[model samples]
Target: MPDSVGKPRRYRELTGLRLGTLVDRLRESLLFLPTVMLISALVLAEFFDHLDHRKIGPVIPERFQFAPEVVTVLLSTIAGAMITAAAVVFSLLLISLHLVSRQFSPRVLRGFWRDRFSHLLIGLLLSTFAFCVVALARVDVAQEFAPPYTVLFALVLTLGSVLGIVAYLDRVIRQQYIGNIMRRVLAESLYLIAGLPYGRHSGGQVGEPVTPPEPGSLGPSLVITAPFDGWVQQISRRGLMTAVPEGTVIRLETRVGAYLTKDTPLVTLWPPPPADQQHRIGQLVARSVVTAAARSMQHDIDFGIRQLNDLALRGLSDVNDPTTAAEAVARLGSLMRPLLMADLPARSVRDESGRVLLTPNDLDHAAYVRHAFDQINVYSADHPLVRETVTETIRMLQAASAGLPGREAARAELDRHLGTSRRHPLLTQAARADHFRSGDRRPRWRSATTRTG
Candidate 1:
């Protein structure tokens, strides 16, 4: 069960169990057993000393008696000390269990307990050996000996040694185990927090219908027109294509089914409508047709604006170098030029008196437009504008192509455009900016124009 803090309550409960088990196991282990037995022997010895009138053979010494007051004080002090040691030992055992659980896998808890048992046994053996040595040393003082006092002192020393060993081990284990566990938990939690995805889904969600573009939007809309002044394309799915005026040429780039941009060409034309069915067609169809075109164009304009903005903000010369003031200026130039040129209406130009004159005609305008486009390209290339604009455009095209069908040629065109501008001076500037400079060293040539000019 989760607690108020969201951590599993079972973990806390299991931790308590581990602590309880550790105390019980330690008491049964050799370390505690020897101490218990030694204290018991000391008490028995004191009891014998209290039997004042008891007589034994000549081999037994009479000087071994413990005074009643001394016995009472010794037993009381020893009992109090034993109780304190037990409490300390219990606390140590609990701490040791917690440390072991945190440092090692839960699977290793058994091995850890086994190791503790072994250490306890070793301590007990060492205590017993020391006691034997002390006993031997006192043999020479047999005439003045109080066996009960000797036994009690030995028990106290042995218990102190065992408790000291347990305390030291507990401290070391707690430090190592707690540190390791805390570090691991912290790292894992951070990774989970960073890696988990959290967001609202965009685009079409499950069971949601595609929203059609709004009417009257200034966008590229597709209008199917009569080709060759003939009747509409007789297809079973009449609704598949929208009807338009006869002789109306629908812009291929305009949104036929979806929103389009003005840059798209008119690919299909419609002939005059049949006189017999002309009266039946409603004016709303024509209006819808125009609305579709406008919406398509609007979408294209929006897309273009977004592309320009992104280019202006994100375009930088190098992946490593922070974007500089110069790089930003170039990116803004790239973004602005397209918008300016896009807003201008189509014009026809004629060479007259060594000057160009403009007129409005659909035909014979390609050469002039091409020449103008070439001039714009040359100006952009010569200027210290965003060099990465071309590269970004190509990347976007490539990305778009990956999703679009039958756009291999468009992708190829974009690739060619990028290839031409890849060696532009702005790109070179970006590259130079990215070049590593040691310490505070700066580049000798700060501007691309200096090299080109």
Candidate 2:
């Protein structure tokens, strides 16, 4: 009904069909790879049958020959096994998701759902069944076109599928351990951060004002509104640069993780478009900004932090596993340190004319530090090991804040956590220092730093 339906397609639709994001989605999907493998196997089975037609006499040697009823029974059984295997794999995976979501943070399920090995194994079972179907169809006693090798290939596929089941089961069992999930999430998170432009570990820009400039008070700008309701996920910088007219600077009001409904202002076009280009400008903007129903780790680093925090929170549950919670807090520290040390990712993109075409809003570091450490700190206060880990993590972060923009936020948080619960008899003589006197070590996580006396 609204202009949301308008289109002038470019590289790909905003439905996450971008080559990079698609590759990620493919890894999460259990159907694609195995389907491709099964199709190839089927084609090969048929081709191999035709090629060796002369070698095998009619009736396919008693050893390989499969009577119609036997072929029917075998194919049916294989198909049944595939369904059973799929059910088992899916059930185990679903249970894993439930356990982690309940025990850990619900957000971490993305990490578990994207298990590529699990996806591949399940796909293999289905594809193997497909191979059998093709192979069985080639067995025709009437025309004497029994494929001896095809039957053999089917038998081999069945064996591989069985082995796959074993491998899948082993992986599922091992992954049930919280430590494994955290490690995978942490490793992948670092890997994700390394690819980001603001990357500190990979040697990108550092020690500067990583914040995007505030909108100028003097400029009156044109506001671009959302045409539909959805979660803002990604923006194609190259497409924005290519689509916008020369000599215009586009400033985004919405960050990557915002949810928008119809008529919500998304971008502010400086030097608003000439009247002639106004109608199509909305379409161009829509083409570049991608939206979806759920948040993804595809573009949001905060999503990664949320996942790790989930793990840490679950450990702090009344189940009395302070060690697990501490482990998560430590990993969260490592993840946050890099971002705090790195510059904000570049937001500006340009065109052939050297005009700034777009500048998406850059998120604040203060929010990240809070999100990374806040909840765990509150939950860990009663648990000494978890509290020490938090203090140790804060101390580590405090040492890094020397010249960083939000360094004070870190210091203030550390100072605030000190006053949280000093009544503990464990406070030693050294703990009596001013730093430990106040419950400031917890610093108002997620809150702005207060320059208190």
Candidate 3:
């Protein structure tokens, strides 16, 4: 396949993934935003100091202008208060995170880490403290010059910081609600789904339709093994294609979200490259595959699914919160509904000329649906409310997948899960018979008392 064909679109996809990866990391980082705020605060201090030196902006009345000593004292007091307040604010946040991690699944901690609002709060508190410190140093008692504008700005920041603490508390409280947590996970999952090459709503295509070489005609193959152990995060198909010679056929042995141990077969190259070029090409292929210590929601839809499953499992644990488990089940159904409408890419990825360059084994809809709901089914078997919710969610998925192209297998998969749920030993004969129908409201509550097990 000619490099020119479909290369532009592929390049965009690769670049977008890199940019997305960087953004996700930044969002999760605690230092990036606060450091930015600190730098901006320093620049602002200097700018205000310049303004105060020339006395150009916002004329200050003689009566309002304070002596350099009073300004020094004011700045010191505000700086000390801000540092102490920062401590209290972050301590409260740490307490909240601990409680959240304990109550919900620790896997959900990523959500809290990516919270821009909390990051902004931290930046504000630190920036206020830094600004005061810089402004305090600028006080020139020898020249009898007090930066009135800078002091005024410090007071404003102090007031804003106090209000921000209140807002942060309110946000933390709302975020702790199980319903909101599910919604956040659902929203993030949908976002990832939207970026996928599959589905009618997606903007880009994985590759042109193409047929692979017949197995009998395919000759000897070279295998590339991973050098380290990590979870496969991203595979840059375009990068791989560009690194290989023309007409090279490559098949990925692992897909995103798969954990790879050292020496794991990473990829297979059919009609292997020349002896001298093999090592170089292998290095490029390995470079194209990104691995990380932990799973991320960037491209791995299953990670989000896993998070919801973890939440459900936590509910089914000693927490004994069936309502939370029910909420999680409903959200999982919502996550699957979009995939039903999406047309997933074929295993074969082709060039612009319809030549197959890579064959990636992506998780099909059935696998995702099973990954999303199966565990909730197993763990929540005894909880009537959770059981009813899981049944209803499977029904919802069935309805969404009905009549959609390329979704027959997924629909069958849902039917199988639904059937398995109905056969739970705790369910009555009547409940099993009426399983396909809407859950009976009275039995859901009545089942609590009529436990067969």
Candidate 4:
């Protein structure tokens, strides 16, 4: 389903994403930064205009104050440079997007689309440019006005924008590497798991009771139909909990990743809704659900894993780049390493009063294991580099999964992989794992590992 895991910080950022309202989207738009900077610059100019009457320029430290002409020159130069930098940043972003799509997967762009750093960096550059323009205009209008404080502030912003662009470019460069991309995906998944209901360090971790609603126990089911068509990206558990009467059990029929159609069974309320409250409650419940044209990692942990798997599959395609495929396995290992000690897929949400507000279908440890490695395992056959990397990664995961729900499964998978390697024609005619253990060079599995490593 859509919203699987999201941290408190990310949840706040997500509210800025409006599925239906253009105004909310505008608030979060990159152009909003320049708009704010223009308005602020005008306001600050007026403030400095008033301060100019109070002899503020002479009061300002001599080091900070510039002559009126010098201030004009500084603002003009910074403004022009920022315009050029903004154009360059925009071009680089487009080029990188194309490169990643060609080399990786187009689906990976969903994660980047919502990247806060990218948005903020673009906003910063545009804001600096807008502020400089406004400041320079004000200075030009005033025949004798220096606006020393305004000039200093503009200078500071210009310097910050310069340094920020450099750092942002570095980040973009690092993201080009497959390993780095996987690491980012892993980090997002970790944050998502950490932010789930059961993720509170104060509460019990993985072993918490996770029983699904029994058929008979769930009272009369009232199907809530979808109000519109879209993917269920996020569920506002708090909104749903607050709207439904206390003690009402909500059985969600739709999950996070499902594509909804008009009249799709979204959820089924227990005991059904009364005549007067039915329409009103349905509307409220619908309000709490956020739908998007596409899936997002804001709540979808599996989507992040799916991205890595896509890369692995890409590497295994006719292109036959085993090294890239191996990178995906290594990254998955890095992602699941922390999962070895943590639980996932929160089954229920509770309010401050400790009432069960919502229960959505969730992933268990076994499901997580399968989802992370299964597809890659299927595609990695015949490619010894990808296969051995997977085996070694699973070995690392098996060691990490001790006392975890998926420990036995990981161990079994590890043994199966080791045992199967001997059967591979590339490995040997003897379907025994001891070939490599015995230091025989009948197969070049070691070389595959070396190249990928």
In angstroms, the error of model 1 at 27 is 80
Q: Backbone clashes per model, in order?
A: 26, 21, 2, 5
Which residue pairs come into collision in candidate 3?
199-342, 199-343
Residue lDDT tens for model 4, 218-282 = 66767889899997776665555555565566666666666789898877776675767888778
Winner by lDDT between candidate 4 and candidate 3 = 3
Q: Write the per-residue lDDT of candidate 1 for residues 65-178, one digit (tens) a residue.
A: 454444445444554554455455557656666765543333223333444543543444344444434443333333433354454555565566566656656554654443
lDDT of 1: 0.35
Query: If the candidates were sorted by their TM-score against the true structure, best first, what order would they fall in?
Result: 3, 2, 4, 1
How does model 2 score by TM-score?
Answer: 0.77
Could you give candidate 2's per-residue lDDT for residues 1-453 as a string of tens digits?
112222233344434335656676776666777677767777777676775575654444577766656766787688678878878888988898898777777776777778878777777777777777666666675644345667766778788889988988888888878788788777767776776664422213212223433458427667888787776667665445445566556676676667778798877776677777776777777766767777776667777788788777777776667888888888888887777776555555443444364445556566777678667655665566776777777778767776677456555654555433345222221233323335567533212111111
Clashing pairs in 4: 1-256, 1-257, 2-256, 2-257, 4-299
The model with the greatest TM-score is: 3
Candidate 4 off by > 4 Å? 1-28, 57-78, 110-121, 140-147, 164-167, 200-220, 237-249, 345-360, 402-453
The alpha-carbon deviation from the true structure for residue 449 of candidate 3, after best TM-score superposition, in angstroms, is: 15
Better of 1 and 3 by lDDT: 3
